[model samples]
Structure formats: C-alpha cells, structure tokens
Target: MLSRSSFLAVIATIAATNVVAAPFTYVNERFGTVCTFPDDIFTDRQPEPDNGDGQQWLSADGASLICSGILNIDDDTPKGFVAAEKASSEPGYKVTYSKASKDWAVLSGLKDGNIFYERRLFGRDGVIRTVWIEYPPAAKSKYDPLVGAIAGSLKAR
Candidate 1:
C-alpha cells in the first residue's frame, strides 16, 4: 500500500504527463504572417519551401497544419477569397461553412474525407496570411477544440 503523500505525488506525475505542451508561435519572414500552434501535436516540421512562403507541420497521427503567406497579386478581398474557395475545383475539396469580413475569412469543411479548417487574414502589406489545419474525422473530438485557438492566433505581423 502507498502512503497518502506518495499516492498524491504519483497522481500528479500522471496528470503532468497527460497535459499538452504550450503552443509555439511561427512567423513567416517573407510576408510577415504569424500563427501559433501546439508543437507537441504537430511534431514533425517539414522543410521550408524554397520560395520562402511559409511552413508545414505534421502530427504523428496523419494530421497536418500549414501556416503560409502569399502575395496578394490579384488584390483579393476577404469576401472574394471566400467565394473563390467555395468555387474551387480541387479534387475532394468542399466548403461546407464559410464566413468573411473586411480583413479575414474562414472556411471549414471536408477534404478527402478529413475535416479541414482554414483561416486567412488580408494584410495591409498586400499579402494574404493563412493557417490551414486538417485531421481525420475520427479524431474530431480530439482536434476540433484546438482548431479555434490555432485559427484565432493567425494574423498579419
């Protein structure tokens, strides 16, 4: 039998092990896009693309998160971007929910059987900052709650 204090200490250790790590901020140098995400959940950071657009991270369980920025060559607005996403013809791309304001747009739906959420910020610097996350439907309960925080942190630096 364990002493009372020993039992409490063991419980605390277990709880600490289960606690998720704090999020880490990622900033895109090329376009000044910024976002935050829990690095423990997205452990594998892929090589940055040669174009210096942004970064991609992958979870051990097949989920992915991408934080990127692109030149707003088309001079797109939030509303127009949302409309273009809805009309996208990419294979297995479907937008079930969408909202747009003057400076931001959000889209959420199924993509290739996985749940995907995307947020974009229209920056004054003629750049569009974006954060896109996708996870398996089976892990919705695990991931759905975190998406909002991740998306909320995406912005122009």
Candidate 2:
C-alpha cells in the first residue's frame, strides 16, 4: 500500500542502518603504535592500562580487539617472535598459520576455541606494535573479511 517513493525511502533507511560505521584510529602515546578499527563493531572501549602500553575494545558478542606495544628488550626479530608465539604454553593457544618478514609478523589460529588474528610491526624505536583481534568461530564469516583492513592499518610512528 505504500507509494513508490516511500518504499524506496524505507529501503534506503534500512540499508543505512545495516552499514558499518567508519573506522576509528587509536594511537599509543607511549610507544607510538597505531591501529584502526570499526568502532561500531568494537563498541565497548575498556579502560587504558596504567602502564600505558595499550588499549582494548570489546563487542557485545564477545569479540575483542587489542592495540598494544611492548618494549623490544630482547631485540627479537619477526622470526623470533613467531617462534616464541608458537612455543607459548598458554592454554588453548595454538598457532595454525604464521608468517614473518624482516620487520613484521602475522599469526592466526585458534585460541580458547575462538579464531584469533594478530599482526605485529617491529618499529625502529625499539618497540613492537601489535594488533590482536579475536572472535568466535561461529562468526568467522562476519569477522574474517574485516580482519585484513584492521590488521593492515597497524603501524608505528
């Protein structure tokens, strides 16, 4: 019973509602690490840690995104970091895929039954900038496509 223009307007409104919002950039003051993510997906921003090392954001459905930096005290290279992650004893942590270059490393696999993707950049400032994103396996189709953009946005100042 709706007019043609009214029907089109309603459809447009619905489409707009389904669209994800623009991404937000977070920069770590201490280590100069930077990350970008869609804030609408990670709606709950947690309190910044006292050490000023990083920031974390959570979604309503249990997904989490962490942007952090750590001192490269051990002078670890990308390959060494990947090796260390693969050797981690953390319960339910398993690295199924890993790749490392001269200055960056990426690890993806299951962690506590959830899918996790992590990207780290070795900065010239003796800091390792990292972005870690994790979500339920059931939401792989939803989150997987967005991971690349989020991970690619990680950098160091």
Instruction: Give the winner by lDDT.
Output: 2
1-157: candidate 2 lDDT, tens digit per residue: 3334533443343344565555677889998888776788899999999999999999988899999999999999999999999999999999999999999999999999999999999988899999999999988776877777678778885
What's each prediction's TM-score?
A: 0.86, 0.86
- Compared to the true structure, candidate 2 yields what TM-score? 0.86
How does each model score on lDDT?
A: 0.84, 0.85
Worst 10 residues of 1 by lDDT: 1-10
C-alpha lDDT (0 to 100) for residue 147 of candidate 2: 79
lDDT of 1 by residue, 96-132 (tens): 9999999999999999999999999998889899999
Q: What RMSD, rounded to one decimal, does every model reach?
A: 9.2, 9.2
